[model samples]
Target: MTQTLDITDRTRLRRSHERGHFDRETINAILDAQPMCSVGYVIDMKPYVTPTLQWREGNHVYWHGSSASRALRNSRDAEVCLTVSILDGFVMARSGMHHSVNSRSVMLFGRAFKVEDPAEKHAKLARFVNGLFPGRYEGLREEHAQDLKATTLLGMEIAEGSAKIRTGPPKDEEADYELPIWAGVIPVTTTVGTPEPDPRNLPGVEMPEHIRKFRL
Candidate 1:
């Protein structure tokens, strides 16, 4: 069955209908492609949103923050929205109101819970580190007991969600297409830069191939 969820709005968001995606494959791709997400929740009757790095394991998404983080503390046991988005290009149209962006975005609505098991929490932390940089955990020093105590990890299962995407050229009005106006997509991309060694580091410690050859 193709699961469907209500989009918050429809009119102002022109492509609300066409832009929304319900497939698991599409949703997972958007989630795995990016490492950052904005978690939204209410704290003390006020809305709060915080940006942080996240990773997925099976159906659950994992995020970590300091134990003292206000956003993390308030999110436990609450309904939350986690969103990951990437802007791929700019849609230049003949009219200002028609201008839009080409993007891949996923919004997940679910309940957040604090991970309580020490062993499981440590394992999840390892996975989170590995997701950011493959083979990094092996090269780095092992986590100390205090490090675990200072961090709080939370997991949320994506109960209901949607992926919205917009790509290709602008959809200007038929009459406006005849107007002498430049119309096209300005493609955007993210690229990795060469690794620079720290000033205090030992001489001739060559950059690892993984760092030199990485691409986002």
Candidate 2:
């Protein structure tokens, strides 16, 4: 497939491209690493973007919502863009304009469609649940028919996509070199906190090791 974003002439949109990554491996890594994405599409001539949790299986990404969701219903068979990003740090510089963020982001452009097969939908739902909490699927109660009917699943093939990453310190002006100021990167990270147990649970129930040791 053709690259999502052409990077040959970097100067035209240098900032966006200089930080843009197009390797398939990098793109997939960014996608798999994040569970949420902002989906962009046009609705009745007005553009809208909504953040929702998503999962990736091979070259396809999937997200589900209520069957009544306007965005989900409207996006069927239409072109869409999905973006996932994680801000890793802040680049503090002497100049305000030079200040930037260190981040890893991926943008996917493709056509989306609703999954109609009940068997496929169930499988996809299982994958989504497992992606969030590994091994939880086998323990949880099976989804009911009514529950499946109320939910709508949409899948988008990764026909074209790119991952962009920016890291390290700021790029200050030549003249700013002599300025006396603190310039460096302030690192940021995401961590899982202590899991809260259900108040109604059995008094002696302990937290599962999977939940305690989870990291992504």
Q: Evaluated with TM-score, which candidate comes out highest?
A: 1
Q: Tell me which residue pairs clash in candidate 2.
A: none
CA lDDT of each candidate?
A: 0.81, 0.81
Q: Write the per-residue lDDT of candidate 2 for residues 1-216, one digit (tens) a residue.
A: 112333333243344433545366777888888888999998888888989988999989998899989989888888888889988889899999999888888887788999999989999999987787887777778889988899999999865766678876788999997999999889899988888888998888777766787788
Per-candidate TM-score against the hidden true structure: 0.88, 0.87
Runs of candidate 1 exceeding 4 Å displacement = 1-22
Please estimate how well model 2 matches the true structure, expressed as its whole-model Cα lDDT. 0.81
**Global lDDT of model 1:** 0.81
Q: In model 1, what lDDT does residue 59 have?
A: 79
Best by lDDT: 2
| Ten contiguous residues with the weakest lDDT in model 2 | 1-10
Candidate 1, residues 1-216, lDDT tens digits: the string is 112233555242334434545345677888899988999999778889999988999878989999999899989989888999999889899998879888888888889999988889989988887776777677778888888888999889855677777887888888899999999989898777777788997788777766776666
Candidate 2: segments with Cα more than 4 A from true spot:
1-22
